[model samples]
Every structure is written in C-alpha cells, then in structure tokens.
Target: MCADYLLELASQLEFETVSACDTRDILEQLLESLAEHSAVTDIPVDEVVLANLHLALHQLDAIARGRGRPAINIPFHVIEGYLLHGFNVKEISELFGVTRQTIHRRMNDNGLRKSDVYSALTQEELDAVIGEIQQSHPHTGYRMMKSFLQARGLLVQTTRVRDSLRRIDPIGTEVRALANRTLRRRQYSVPAPNAMWHIDGNHKLIRWRFLVHGGIDGFSRLIVYLSAATNNRAATVLEAFIGAVNKYGLPSRVRSDKGGENMEVAQFMVESRGENRDSHITGRSVHNQRIERLWRDVYIQVLDQFHILFSNLEREGMLNPDDEGHLFALHWAFLPQLRRQLAFFMDAWNLHGLRTAGSQSPYQLWASSRHHEDPDQVEADYGIDWEGPYGFDDLGHQAGQVEVPQVQLQRHLTEEDMARLPDPNVHFMDAIDIYKATLQQLMQPRSEVDEGGSDA
Candidate 1:
C-alpha cells in the first residue's frame, strides 16, 4: 500500500529536461537569476496557490529539522520558484522567507573560510606515507595513520590525513573511545515492581554542570526519569524523584546507593511526600541495595551517550562559531527531544536487545511469570495424600530447623576473582581499591578488615 502510494505520488511530479547550460547558469547566478527569470516570465500565483505550496513546503522543512539541519529564515515564494527552476537562489530565499541578499550573506557568514593549503604533508609525501601504511598496517584508518605519521616526524592533523585518504581511496573514520569495554551481562529478574530498579546520574557540563537522574524498572526495564537538573543538589534529586513518582505512581520501593546526600534526603519533607500524604495515602520508602554493579553500568552508558552527542555536535560544527552560548541554548532547547529519544532507546532495549542471562530482554520475562500456579487445587497438584507426604505427615509435623545462608554475600571467596568485591559507599576510587583488595585476599589465604566499616 505504502509503495503504491509513493509510486503514484512520483508519477504526478512533472519532469522537465532542463538544459545543462540552463542548470549551470542557474547554479552560477543562484536565486538572483531566478528572480530575474521570474520577472521576465510574468508568472503570477494567487494566495491559495501560495498557501498550498507553503503547506507542502512545510513537510520538507520538517524533514530538514529532523535531519539536524540548521534553521534559517528566508522568503519561501522566491525559493520555491527557484527550486522549480532547480535549486536557484531566488527559490531558496522564498522558502526561507528571506531576501536573496540576506540568504547569501547568512550562507557566507556560516561557511568555513579555512584555506585548503595544508602545509604538513605534500601530495608526494602523503602518497609515500600511504604506501608505508599499506605495507605495514593495511587496514588502519586515518586516526591510526595520524599516529603512525606523528611517530615518523610527520606533523599532520588526523582530519587532514583523513581528507587526503578520502581523495586517494575509500576511507572513513569509526569514532571509538579507548576506554570502552565489553561487559559480561548479568541479568536480574524480579517477580514484581519494587523488587528492584537501577538508578544512576548522568553528569555533564555544557556551560553549567547538569545531572540526569535515570532509573530503570528492574522487572519491566522501563526507565523512570527521576530528574534532570543543572545542579546535583539533594533538593534537585528530591524534585526529580517527586516528578517520577507523580508520573509512574509510587513503586513499592526504590533502590539506590547509600551516598551521604541521598542518605539524608527526607522524602517525607519533600513536596511530593506532603502531597501524597495529604491525599491520605501511604508512600513507599527508598531501599538501598548492593547493586553497585548495575549503577556502574548505568553511569558508563549515560556518560558515553553524552560524549557521543556533544562530540558529534561539536565535530559537525553545530556549535556556534562566534559565541559558545549556543551550546547551552541548543542543549536546553533540545532537552525534551532528548528525553523522547531516550524513551525510544529504552523501548528498544526492553524489547529486542539481548541480555547477559539467556540473552533475552527483560520485557520477555516480564509478560510471563515463571512460578505461576493455581491456588485452588493445592492437594492434588502437590500429590500430598490424605495423611500428607508419607514421611512428613506420618512423623506428625515434628519441629525441625533449617539453616539459611545469611543474606550477606561472602567476600573475597575466590583467589583469582578477589577483585570483584563491591564498595558499600559507592565511591569510585574506593570501589576500585576494594575490588583489588578482595582479589588479593582470594588469591592468597589472608583476611583484611572491611574497609567500609573501618574507614567511614
């Protein structure tokens, strides 16, 4: 159906065999020539035709915006006419609702004025370098090439090297951070909401420091936006929690790190707490857990995304050339859009993304319960006779004891895996130290005092 509709629409577009010279002439003079051509043609359009054209043009405008294309105000009528004549300046101006002179001036203003005279490597030198690369590391990209050249006393920017390679061969750069690692998946399944949730902060400094409070439902893996703020104050966190509670309703509980600030955050004193109590309903309290493993993963993901977003924006020159103020403005203005995009990502993660355990998404198990059983037919299902299971029933329910493994996880259990110990305080440096200490203890038959209790 969609394909047929697109084909039908394509058939309606009038095609013209524009002369090559005409196209070149239009390109040379741009909109100035188009306006001149229109004046000579004496073609007049009414308001209705103009309005319909404007509406149609809006669709394209939306596409451009979605593509991260910069916005400009230009005259649509002239630009539309120019496009009809094959992307002439007059039509572009009309589309932007700006004059031809204004459009041209703005284009020049934003355009890169850098000279192409790269001085570091001449064409012959570049060829020789490429030959060496092909001989040594044939598969290396421009970044590797840049590093290789630097070691050989060639002062060439990676960008310059990349550009040169593009001219000589099909070359592309795959942006990757050195610190990235593939983490083994550890899945946790909770039978109900409040069983568990992952919480972490994504911090950034565009102009001012900002933190995004993110929490993922353990069962559904649905993300709950606790808050996003310019400051990482206790109050800011509280406000975010309030917002999340208001949206998702209070979960039976929340699990987070035992950071000093969060430990002191009295949710009842917060506005959301008062409001919920005023409605005469009880609210859930926050729960702490040894889920540092999950928080570490969450923090890395948030920081990675932040770096990728801004890095791309900066590299693409989406940042303002004159004043850096545009960074803050652009980021804040796009905050809502970012949130929506995050939601889309979360959905993808929950539905299709593989997990560490059984390689299944959280959403898969969420829809079906593993231990579901009918309560009514307890006796027959259990296969308990009238006297109960032979041994237990005949013995007349003797009082017996069963030992339970205390919920405390054993510390430094294995020699080689001692470094896996978790820190109670959730401090990054402390966590690393604890991990190393545990690994040492596991590898050697030695015991150390729990630093968490002794230090703090």
Candidate 2:
C-alpha cells in the first residue's frame, strides 16, 4: 500500500519513482529527487519538509550522494563567497554534491562567475598607476584618484589606490591640508557666464606692496582680467575693471567691497545701470567670499614664492633699499617677470580641470553657458576704448608738470596769532591751557585788514 501511495505521489510531482527493496529506500530516492527539483526551480522548501527529507535520506545512508548533501540545502551566499574568491563550478559542485550544470546556474543567478574574479594587480603595479595620477592631479583624494584611473580604462578599487597613495605620494598630505582650509560658505547661483562679476585686490607681497587686482565671473569662476600695480588706488581699480569689461562683455551686476579704491568702480556701475538698480558695493570683504577665496590661491601659487625670492635678493644687496637705480632695476627687470608668471598662472587656472565642475575647465564651462546669457543685459559698447586719454602718458603730462594758480601770503603774524602759540618752556598743562585760550581767540571774529597791510 505504501509503495502504491509513493508511486502515485511521485507521478503527481512529475518524477518517476525508482524501484527499491522497501519503503525507506523508495522514500530516500524520492527526497533526493525533490531536493534536485527545488535547486532547479530556485524555490525554497519548507523547513518541516526539508527536515523530513533529510531524516529519510539518513535512514537509508544516502545523505552523502557523491561527497556531501544536495546543493539546495547550502546557502547561496556561501556559494557566492567561494565564487568571488576564484572557485570554479566543477570544484564547487564536487564539494556541495551538485551537478556542474546546477552550480553554473546557481552562479549565474547570484550574478557572479569564475571569469568575474580576476587576480588582483600587484602592489607595485598599483603604485605605478597611483603615481601617474598624482603627477597629473596632486590634490586628488582617493575617490577622485579612483575616478581618474577608471576614466583612463584602468579598473582599480578606491581602497587599494588609497593604500598605495599613502605609501608613495607625499604631496597628497599637503593637498589635504589646503583642502581643509578651503572656505565652506554658501555661494549665490548664476544661470549664465556674464550674470555677475566679482572683483578684489590682493596685497600680500609686503616689501613691494604690489596690489594684484582681479575680476572673476561668478558663474564660471573664469578670471576676466588680472593686473599688478604699485597701489590699490581708484585709478588702478578703474583700469582693471575697464580691461575686464572690454574683454568679456559687461556683467549684469558687479560686486565688490566698500573701500575707497572701489569707489570709482561703484560710481561707474551706478552710472551704467542707474541708481535704482543694484549697487556695486556689497557689505564687507567677508561677504564677497568668491574673490576673497581666490586670493589664497594666488598667494600659495605665486606670491609666496616670489616674496621668498625677493627677500633673498634684498639680503644679497641685489635689491637695494636706498638706491633709486636699484629700485628702477627691480621694477623694470623683476616686475615684468612677475607679471609674466601671473599670466601663465591665469592661463593654467582657466584651462585646468576643476573637480567641482565635473572635471571641466573654467573656460570650457563659461563657453558652454554663453548661449543662455541675455543679449540685452550685455552692453553694446562694452569693447570700446572707454579708457581713452585717462592714463598719465596719454594725457601728455609728466609728474608735477601741471601749473598751479598763485595766491598772496600774509607778510607777518598778528599779535593775537603770536600770543596763541604754545610757549616752548611752559609746563605741559600750562601749554595745553595757553593752546586752548589761543584757539578761542583765533576762533573769534577777526577785524578787517587792508590787502597791503597787517590787521588793525
């Protein structure tokens, strides 16, 4: 009766029951077939049913079909771990007592295979790859380095690259330090290149007091113009502003700090856009953080090194303090070199890839956003020579060459003026009293005096 029942059950389950000596053998074979079916269909068997199958197999001494229990009972995660470590299907099949086909199917289901687990690159090879990336981008952290490597068709894990960089790249340390010092203030967004402009001056070069005035586009951070002069006066600031406007059309708004040097620029902006519109002057420099942050980069890349060289030259007497000839030589010879270096720095800054901008250069970003800019906002005569006859040489006048109108002077001091002066030999308190009294006497109304004579 049991054999009949087993055969009927096997038929219902779509499997042919093998002939056996007793009910136990028949049950063991049936359980083995069920396990195989479960593995094939990837449907988990209930724990009560699985336990019953294992008991029936154990009773018949069939738990070890080839080497171990069926693959259906083993967890898929364990199999995946072995596969990731370079284990092949044949080996795994033997260990789990599963067919090669079953192992392969399970591996495919788990999204892994022998081919997916290649041998990791040697430490030396990883160092070489990291070194090359560091040479190009010294400030790149481990994650950026990984991106850079992948972009060049080299597949490497970020963890491995980071370990290799710590061992071989020393500049990575300084890069991290500078990165920490970077300001984290929020910045205003602009839709187009010429939407807004930020301008500021850097005066860190102490000995020469060279002021580097620069303007940058707020949207793209592209340096519009950079100039080095002896002072941060109104004329110097105006020249820089006009030069930038001539190159990149007028910005919708100009932003700067409320300093005397920027007064002329503020006036120009007011005159151009009308007083009802936005003013050029912002709050303090801390509020204008874009251009203020750029000053740090300029100091680190150019001004600091130049200051060191200048100090050494001065110590060696090549740059004299009192000699006017030496001063002229310093200005004519070294100043031009500094300006050339600044130009080179600006070129590199504009062309180099910025990680914040998706590895695009500032110039590239600005060029891409050009179409979105408003044509009406741009000044039509922006490129005109607005600085005509403004410089000293263009006005055809040398220093102190302008004539001054003459004014007549009093021939002598009156008695009241003489008495109001402080006595040289008096006590400090008495001198203060006499000075106050004399000031009061001078403040009183003065009697009329003839043009050719003293006061009566």
Candidate 3:
C-alpha cells in the first residue's frame, strides 16, 4: 500500500501511522492495513508492504539514544559488507539491529563513503544488460528487474529499470506493470520467529526415489531445515521434524499438507503444544505457501541441473529405469552430490536478500526477530532453562557451525551393488569432481562390474 492509503487507514483507525510507539503499535497498524486492504485486494500483505510498513512504524525506535555522548562504534568490515551489498544506511540500520544514526556515525568514523551515482554504468550499457536478462526472465517487471540489477551491484533506480524493461520487452513489461498496479497488498502474520512453521515434502525428484522434505519459519521466512531423503516414509520426515524441534524448539504452530508422512509430525505438534487444535494445520499441498514457495528456488538453483544430468544419462545408452544396477549406481553417485548442493543452496538462500523482508537476508530477519524472552524470563514462564539453540554460544550469539546429522539413505543395500560400486566420497570433492568420478565409475561395463563383484 502507498503512504496515502496507510495515512487514510490510520485516520480511519484514529491513530498516527507515523509515530507508532512500539511493536504492539506496528502489529495494530498491520492488522488495520490488512482489514482495510482486504476490501480492495482480498489478499494478505506482501513482502514489499511488510518491509516498508516495518521501517515506517519502527523509524522512531531506530533513533539513536544517549544523544549527547559519543556514537556507538561498529566493526568497519560489517559496515563495508552492508554497503557493498547495495543497502542504504536506513535499510542497513533497520536490519543491522542498530539505529540509523549509529550507522551514519560509524561510516564517518571508518572514513567510508557510499556513492549514489553508479558512474561506471552508462544508460546504454544498462539497457543492453537488461535486454539480456529479459531474454531469460521475460516476465520480469521493473520492481523485480531493479532487484536483479541491485544483486549485480548496479544499484540503479526503479524508473531507470522500468525504462530499460519497457524498451527491451514492451509487451511483457506493460502486462506485468498493469498487474502490479492492479494487485492489492497481501501479507501473512506470525508473531515471532518460532511462532509458526510451514513444513512440506517436495516430490519433484520422487520419480527417481529421491524426496526433499523441508520447513520455513512463517515469520522470518527462515529455512529451518531442508533435507534430501531416499524415501518419504513417515518415520523419515518425523526424524527431520524432531531434529528441527531439537534445534529451534517447538513452534507455536506447525502447518503442512494432509499426507501420511506428516501425520506423525502433526501428532507430535499436537502433543507438544498443549494438545490444541491450532497446533497442527493440515491442508492441500498447494495451500502450504511458505514451504511450497521453496520448491521453485530449489529447482532454479540446483534440482534442475541434476534433472538435466539424469535425463541426459537416460537419453544416452546409460540409464535404464527398469534396471536395478543403473538405479543403484545413480543413488550411490548422485545423492551425496544432491545433498551437498542442497546445503549450499540453503546457505545462499538464507543469506540472499529478499525484497519482501526489506532486503534483509532470511537469517538476518530470523536473528533480529528472535524471541524476546530473557533467560530468567524463559525459566519463569516455561519452567525450563533455554539458551536459544545448539548453534548458539553462551553469550547467545549464533556460532558459525552447528553439527548437522548425516543423512542415512533408507534404501537397503544388496551385497552385489555394495561390492561392485566405486566410492565417490573423496575428501575436498567439488560437485564436478564427484560427478566426473561417479560417471567414470558408472561407465565401466556391467560385465566388468559383475566380475569385480564376483572377484570380491
């Protein structure tokens, strides 16, 4: 929604949207916006609205305190990282868990200057670049195009991006722009980071006996866990669910589809959350927006490449779906590759800025929106000691690494395939190295492989 609309809503609600005192006011404003916009768009608030409204409501909260004293210093490297990532001082300050004045003071102290003019990129050069991007993402409008350009460190204006897109692909640009103008703001609500989680299984690779089960926090959109598994059995997904609960603790609610695999998790959520009806929600897979949304990212980032690789193997004389040997060979070769790729994707995803979350990375949002309960408060309220998660140190800072349990493929190994297949778990192996090693191993004649097994 625009400022005019927000102002109108606040006028109707009899509150000043500009000077919302605290998070409670933010929530009150958010609900007012939702109720007002529902009449027009019939949808919830979206990311852009979420981000802009938050920065607006919390503007006062982000003011520097102790005004007469020296500015609080921040590490130069962290500030540099934010600046290089194309974040302005205000957005960085909001997401950095600090006041805007502090960020400005630190920039001055560190002798750093962020330039608004991207002097090196000429309009003609940007037009050519955007034309190329349109060749792939034809449906991309100026807003998303701006994000794409920002990601490339261009830091161009939305109006400039619109000019480029309109010139490059006039029809597509007009259609998307019209849609944007007409679409109403939509948003989902969750109180805190662990307030609710949307969990689901991805069946894109199920044709090859591969399944991906994952969860995303509803509030921060943080990925709690993303796993590659050989099967979608109830026990398997339950183990993944339990593992996440062990890390982040029980969310106030768990949302998933009405599949058998989620039944156990649903029961666990119900039992864990005071046996309440609202603890676990079941519905069609399409309705689980948070986790369902992740499938697209996985496909674009990693899953599609693997799909092409396997499809090529099938097109050639190599892979036969009906053959056990070929399937087993693929399992031994590629599952590890898939797991590692997913891990990398997970990291990149968590760190990648979202236009929705006000340009904060998912991890950044999760960290900043963590539960407000102090240690003593948590003990008093829940009658249990809490120290965040296993990834946290004593000071409550998240450590760089947390031990992730190794995935144990549920596929049973016959004695023959075990003796015949070459090991691909080389130390310091990259995806290419793993693929090359496994393909070479798989190309060995079936007769030779059998003979090797017989010899063994």
Query: In terms of TM-score, which candidate is strongest?
Result: 3
lDDT of each: 0.41, 0.57, 0.62
For candidate 1, write residues 1-456 as lDDT tens digits: 222332344344324244333433333353354347447755432332344334434544554357533354434443333322223354445544558786666545555111211235677778777665544344445544554454344546446777766655553333222222343333343455433344544443223234455666555555555344544555556666555544444543344443333432345333322332221111111121222333333334334455455556567765432332343343334444345434433443444323343433444344332222212211111211122111111124321221211112233234333333333343322333443343343334233334532454
Off by over 4 Å in 1: 1-191, 204-208, 242-249, 259-330, 353-360, 370-456
Q: Which structure among the candidates has the greatest lDDT?
A: 3
lDDT of 2 by residue, 234-255 (tens): 8778978876765565776777
Which regions in candidate 3 have their CA more than 4 angstroms from the true location? 1-88, 91-98, 111-187, 242-250, 267-272, 351-364, 370-456
Q: What is the lDDT of candidate 3?
A: 0.62
Clashing pairs in 2: none
Candidate 3 TM-score over all chains jointly: 0.53
Residue 200 lDDT in model 1? Answer: 45
TM-score of each: 0.31, 0.44, 0.53
TM-score of 2: 0.44
Clashes of 3: 5
Residue 431 shift from truth in candidate 3, angstroms: 7.5
Residue 199 in candidate 2, Cα distance off native in Å:
0.9
